[model samples]
Target: MSLTDSEILLLEQLIHDREVDKLFSRLTTITEETNPNYKLLFEAINSQKWGFNDKNRPVV
Candidate 1:
């Protein structure tokens, strides 16, 4: 599925929001960043729910 320009901007806005900082930080951390959970991370990130065009709310 392809995303339009607006959708890309929307997700970038959501990801940059302060509320999502913790998860972003964790993903950048040493241990977590090197974990084998890369598959899950890749899946979630590639999914429409967390990618550039995702419209769903993130599970808190």
Candidate 2:
């Protein structure tokens, strides 16, 4: 079965949101930690800009 354009778009959005949510959760956990090793990882994830690309696809 083929998905309609809207359905495909919705699915893509859901996936993107889930990934961002996971990243945010990880970031939160890292923030709560005292280990300095996580600092760089937290910074990297925090500095990442998430948005849709020109093709309307999610970019992380």
Candidate 3:
């Protein structure tokens, strides 16, 4: 299958968002308190409803 230019851009943005989510997760893990920034990032990561395969059945 082929992706259009807009689809490709969306895919790129999703990948970048996932990377940022990973970074936030790691930072949150290392930090002691669940500060506002960490809470916001955690919520943003959890709020994402896409990026998972059939077997995963959860946020990616």
Candidate 4:
């Protein structure tokens, strides 16, 4: 199956948002000098998400 232009754009936006969410979460922890949110911490990062597991589910 093929995605239309808008679907592709939305997919790109979702990926970007997920990455930004985790980055912001990480930054907040760093600024506070505290432990990370383990749930977010354990989820495969952007680089690893594709191959990590349960490939059907979206990364965020």
Candidate 5:
């Protein structure tokens, strides 16, 4: 799928903010195999809301 300027900007920002690294781990050559941690990270990023309170603040 093609991405718009805003999407690209957000992606760039995500990287700049170090959110991307926290989202996905090492790149995989084979789609069938990947680190389970990466999957968990992906789910966390896409989840509706972060499982934490503002005052407590959870580590990403």
Candidate 6:
């Protein structure tokens, strides 16, 4: 699925604006896994998971 220039521009703008939720909503059904913004989107989605220590370890 090739995105037109306008779509590319919007994606870029979303990345620039850090509009993660809006971007994620728009990208939900995307077929282009290699889209350049994918990494940025994935990072944005996972950005808040870095400080979690819930590793599911059993406690005595």
Top candidate on TM-score is 2
Report clash pairs, candidate 3.
none
Q: Candidate 3: where is the Cα deviation over 4 Å?
A: 31-60
For residues 1-60, write the lDDT of model 3, one tens digit per residue: 999999999999999999999987777673556587767887898788776677876554
Model 1 segments more than 4 A misplaced: 18-60
Least well predicted 10-residue stretch by lDDT in candidate 2? 26-35
TM-score of each: 0.31, 0.51, 0.48, 0.48, 0.30, 0.30
For model 6 the local lDDT of residue 20 reads 72
The parts of candidate 5 lying over 4 Å away from their true place are 19-60
Clashes of each: 0, 0, 0, 0, 0, 0
Q: Estimate every model's Cα lDDT from 0 to 1.
A: 0.69, 0.85, 0.81, 0.68, 0.66, 0.70
Model 1 alpha-carbon miss at residue 52, Å: 44
lDDT of 1 by residue, 1-60 (tens): 999999999988987896678878666564644767775685566665432436665653
Give the range where candidate 3 is weakest over 10 consecutive residues by summed lDDT: 25-34
- Residue 7 in model 6: lDDT: 98
Ordered from best to worst lDDT, the candidate numbers read: 2, 3, 6, 1, 4, 5
TM-score preference between candidates 4 and 6, better one: 4
Query: Model 6, residue 53: displacement in angstroms?
Result: 51
In order, what is each prediction's RMSD in angstroms?
15.1, 10.8, 11.7, 12.1, 10.8, 13.6
